[model samples]
Target: MWQQSQAGWQTDTGAGSVMQHRLRGLSGKLLWLTMAFVMLAEVLIFVPSVASMRLRWLEDRLNTAAAAGVVIDGLQPAELPRAVQDDTLMATGTKAIALRKDGTSRLLAADHMPPQVDAKYDLSDVPAFQSIGDALYTLLFGGDRMLRVYGPIGDSDMIIELVMEEKGLRQAMLAYAQSVFSVSLMISLITASLIYIAINRMMIRPMRRLTHSMQVFAENPEDPARILPPAPGNDEIALAGRHLALMQEQLQKTLKQQRNLADLGLAVSKINHDMRNILASAQLMSDRLVDVDDPMVKGFAPKLVRTIDRAVGYTSEVLAYGQASEAEPKRRRFRLAELCQEVRDILAIAPDSGIDFVDSVAADIEVDADSEQLFRVVHNICRNAVQALANHRLDDPGALRRITLSAQRIGSVVAIAIDDTGPGLAPKARENLFTAFRGSARSGGIGLGLAIARELVLAHGGTIALVEKPGPGTLFRIEIPDRPVALGDWRVRA
Candidate 1:
């Protein structure tokens, strides 16, 4: 059942070995370990029991011999009948019986006594370990030899000595040992079986269920039905199951969202070619309107052209979503005030509309960035601000409806702040602020504006974030860093 190794006997664990494979499993291991420990406890008890049995057997012989010796010593050696002496010796299982009193040894009975004794025992004060060792020695390697056994008769100075055959004692011990082995084997098997059943029910079975659930979930993670149900309890296994269930639920929702987005992209792609051609035709017609001399026609023609151009750009951005990442920013020097003013012009807040566009940036302040991409970044945010302000209802009629743009230079980075007097972002919007399709600050918004804005800003090696303040308005901060100059170019410019 076990093989020897450098670390002592080990159960075979090689994969090719059937026994090793069986023992390698948790159930097999638990069963065997239970049995091994139970047997170990049995063996420990068995040793002392055998030793005690040996001691008790010898004491019984001494007791019987002592009683017979007392009677034999009282009568003259010739007066004791030879048949009676033989019967007493046979009953006590001794060849000869003697008594020692006052340093004088008296032979009470004799029947062909052996010339020499092979071993001796003084049962008065033997150490427990020594007794056990002697018992084990006799059980393993004893031979047919004579044993001289002597000890004090109970409560008397008279000591009884008996010369006995070791073969009889060995045989009795062997019989007792056999009985103990059988009993121990049964007890260990029963105990180990009980414990194994309890553990298998309590721990192993639940673990197997957990592993099976995980395997089934892994095979089809997107399937809602494959998610593990919450197990009841506060145990580690239950906690793990709860967590796995939660994770699977989240993965399912994410996969659903991804599928929806994929479908949207496909639909957009199919209509994209026709949409671009229609926008191009509209652009051509709007360009022709630029030549009209009528004041009303001339005033609206430029705005119409710009609007159509922006619409074409919007269509392209939608089609390109989720295809490839944004291109690297082409950095160049531009005035911050001009960019902010352009965003205001594109928005074209009507005079009748209850909204104010405040460009607070000074004309002298400059920024190093990609002008076209930076315009998209600023325009998208401002446009979202416009929509938010237009939709929000102010509790106070006198509350200002204003969208402000401000900028400052700090080291090699330009910081731009956009503030709007509107209802602050909703809780859900703040949570997924830069996430596409989820960060809508207002109702009926796809939240792609800020997502695209964040992309463009990041491409310029800058950062964009919603700034929290204690007020009923939204604030955004955009910081764009200047591109690093080469050492040679720096020296040349200097």
Candidate 2:
């Protein structure tokens, strides 16, 4: 009972809004539309009815006048009394009645001279719209003014005319309009109620359910219970609910994965803090191996030292790069060719390494970039190419093993292409090409080099992409442009 009362109040509140605010809710809009359409329909029906009412009223007057004319014409002239004439005029509801017979005007009844006809209507052959328009005109503006109506009387060679007042026609029209309005009001209420109920059940309720689900989901998205339950139909609302549920499920799963990655990063930070000191101590011990005298120890000492140095460098880089974001670069101009030489020299290519390093940049070409970040970007690519070339292990005499670094300055941008003549990347590595810990091509590589290189390159507002050719090697293209020149102190220039 309370729910029913609340619904009634809601309906009344929606309906009782001022005209300016009436069309607010779903129910209110439906009600207004229904009333408008029903009233329009009633108006359509009322005009013709008023027009028809006038037509019938005029016909009855003409018929009564004709009947009176027949009765008076049948009587002798001496027997026609003034009282009978007055009675006939009153019965016909006209000031006068006349019959035109054989080209002669014969008055059946007339108590006085009929007033001048304000309007004339020929009932026998009038167009429909004109008749309707004239009827409306009389109802709106015609007071007690007189009207003349004429029509053929049966098969005789005579026409009947009646002069009557417009008041009766107007009054009848008002009554007819009142009747139509009452019925239209009832129909509007019933139709709007049915349509409002049907549409609310079909659409509004479902939309409300989805809206509530989204609000709850937004408050605490990780709670699985907040997801919307799928509705049970093949309609658009049901489909939308299902798609929303699936999106919430996928988002929850992604949030879980992100939380796990954050926890792992915290754990790795703790381990790296202690591991750095231990690796430092190991490095000191490994340096002492230089003074050992054993032959096997001398043979393996260099390789072991290099491996530990690489391990220490890897740890420091991984920890620094694991920061929330890479630090912004300090920009400066530097020699590109000189930087490439430093990277190649650091790799320390042996005479029998079977890999050729070709640097083709111009000696004087310079780039505006961060020295440390650009060095890492170039070094990582060159080192990866060197390692890839060494991995080929060409025992056959004629196999080509080459890593080439070439560059060109194109207008405002410098385009550098790194080409290698070694084995290309596998499909999985190409798919996750620049992603961290995923684009690994070598065993035990951690896959952070290219990812970090891409990150640093992006920080300089440049792009790095791989270009593939028909040969065995993979090509990486890097383009870095100079920063925009800032306009300073226009007053001084002026």
In terms of lDDT, the best-performing candidate is: 1
Give the deviation of candidate 2 from the true structure as CA RMSD.
7.6
Per-residue CA lDDT of model 1 for 1-494, tens digit only, reads 23346334233344346556545779778988988898899899999999999999999999999888888777756557789989999999999998998899988889998999999999888899999998998888985788999999888899999999988889999999999989988998898889878987877777878888889988998888888878788988888888888888988888887888899888888798789999999999999999989999998898789778878987787665567787677888989898787788789899888899999999999999988788888988888889888888888888899999999999999999999988888899999999988887678987788888888888888899999888778999999999999999999999
TM-score of each: 0.86, 0.63
Off by over 4 Å in 2: 1-24, 67-96, 110-134, 137-148, 154-157, 165-167, 186-210, 223-325, 328-368, 379-451, 471-473, 481-494
| Candidates' C-alpha lDDT | 0.87, 0.82
Query: In TM-score terms, which candidate is top?
Result: 1
Model 1 stretches with alpha carbons more than 4 Å out: 1-25, 76-79, 282-323
Give per-residue CA lDDT, model 2, range 174-257, as digits (tens).
777677778878887787778777977898779878988999999999999999989899999999999999999999977876
TM-score of 2: 0.63
